[model samples]
Target: MDKLEGKLHKLEFYISLLLQMVDDTKYPFFKLVIENQLSEEEVTEVIELCKQTEIDFYVQKEQGWVIYEDLLAQFVGQLNSKLPVNQVIKSLYDQEMYSELMGEFLSIIAKHN
Candidate 1:
């Protein structure tokens, strides 16, 4: 099932990307589970789990460098919400701060995994 496989791929991709952000941020551990035979419903459930586990950590921004702990916490909170994937992504992408950090984190994730 391409549709289901695609969703899994997307979830895996997002989990990996989010993990990358978490690794660099203050919250060392966050709830991120990668499922093999996941339906859309299950993926959303995992997202909700992640949201509740999100912690508000401090961050500092200086020049071109940003601490990103606060941004990562916000990202996790958004990630775990019950919102539709497209809607959640749209909101996240619209916010330039998270969007840019996500891009960098995704790039870093690609290299590592």
Candidate 2:
């Protein structure tokens, strides 16, 4: 479970980095949600769920960010698909913009949850 938790923590760290580029007002809320989500058992449960579902959860393994499943990933892909070519390029190349986008996505998830 140590390896799994390590991976989970890595994922969280990337998320925190992404959130950093978003509205400062959202940070505390985001931090709360992330902290709540990061318990050891929770990480293990998440990994088990991913395994049972056979989802390619990791989007960028080197960066330790996971998109969970293709359906969810496709949704994000769709969001990116609508962007102007230049904006898309910027989103790809600009960490802050990418973080802002991910933060917006996380905020939406937090709202519905």
Candidate 3:
């Protein structure tokens, strides 16, 4: 795969994983996919936005691209929960799942390349 193709695939895989991690019904991030209305252009735009912001977890919502931190905060706020997005991310890192996930992602990229 070429560089752009690899990046697109990575973004798609990341978004798919995000969908699995969150409650799609409650998150606007998954709306496009769930409603079968997602477009390639939008996906590309989302990827570009993430690259520009240096944040890999941006999601394409109806209003536009939203960072994962904001999405998680909104979700937690709505639920009146004490668990913040940073804490969740820190927990993942503390458990080493983040590293495992990154390793898997790199392996997948290598296989594609």
Best by TM-score: 3
Task: Report the lDDT tens digits of candidate 2 across residue range 1-113.
Answer: 99999999998799878766765443433343353445655445433542433333233433576443343354444432223323322332243423443443444455556
21 Cα displacement, candidate 2 (Å)? 0.8
lDDT of 3 by residue, 17-47 (tens): 8667775334433333333444666545543
What candidate 2 gets wrong by more than 4 Å, as runs, is 25-113
In the order shown, the candidates' Cα RMSDs to the true structure are: 13.6, 15.2, 17.8
lDDT, model 2, position 9: 100
Q: Where does candidate 3 stray beyond 4 Å?
A: 28-35, 39-113
Clashing pairs in 3: none
- When sorted by lDDT, best at the front, the candidate numbers are 1, 2, 3
RMSD (Cα, Å) of candidate 1? Answer: 13.6
Highest-scoring model, lDDT: 1
Which is better, 2 or 3, measured by lDDT? 2
Q: For candidate 1, lDDT tens digit of each residue in 11-79?
A: 879887866665323332122222233456766665454333222212233334445444544554555
Q: What is the TM-score of each candidate against the true structure?
A: 0.25, 0.23, 0.27
Model 3 residue 33 lDDT score:
35
